[model samples]
Target: MSTYSYRIVNVFTQGDDPFSGNPLCVFESAESLDTPRMQALARQFNLSETTFMLPSTRANARVRIFTPSYEMPFAGHPTLGTAHVCRALGLAGDTLTLEMQAGLIPVYATQRRWTLQASANGPSG
Candidate 1:
């Protein structure tokens, strides 16, 4: 049997409301899980987005974003949530870079707030 660890967080929260922001699930570690398993887990969580953390050669860590139906190259809330989890788990510091399918993303944290640098080009024109 295999046990996976994960954390649930709210991004873009307003005030102290727990349900104020978008909910995201971030898997603490996904080095053993494959694409199919990751997809299934995302479907099981049924959140707007789920993130898996993996080791990265180019950045602090590698992140994969997934929805119930398919995988996403990148997403804002998920990126922020994952960065928060990374910092909590000692995987990264206040400023770290995440390697995503879309590209390498730079994330920064100030206190409890997290931010990510967006790409110049949009997904679609």
Candidate 2:
């Protein structure tokens, strides 16, 4: 197996719950991605959350969100925080698509912060 190359970046994103502190992540990426390595990366960060960026064989970038415990399909803070890091690291565009386990998540961004909207491709109520 090959190594998953990732960049550890610190970020902050406010969640609905006031008590929920800003999430952080050590964004991981490489030629391939898997669960065990993803879990290990999350553990290493030991933050409110972590993420792995894996571009899908189909289209758009596949993003995996993880807490210290288990992986999450769609998360507000993780989505925003990862976008922030991706943009900061010059890996994002004005508008980008995030392919999470849930589905295709469209992300819009500005110079300062990122805004996420949930749709059939993503989270919906």
Count of steric clashes across candidates, in order:
0, 0
lDDT of 2 by residue, 1-125 (tens): 55555555434425544344564664546435568877877887787678887767542467888888898888877777677666666676767777777876777887656788896454632
The lDDT for every candidate, in the order shown, is 0.91, 0.69
- Candidate 1 lDDT tens digits, 13-73: 9998988899999998899999999999999999999999999998888999999999999
Q: How does each model score on TM-score? A: 0.93, 0.73
Worst 10 residues of 1 by lDDT: 116-125
Point out where model 1 deviates above 4 Å.
122-125
Model 2 regions more than 4 Å off: 1-21, 57-59, 120-125
| Number of the top lDDT candidate | 1
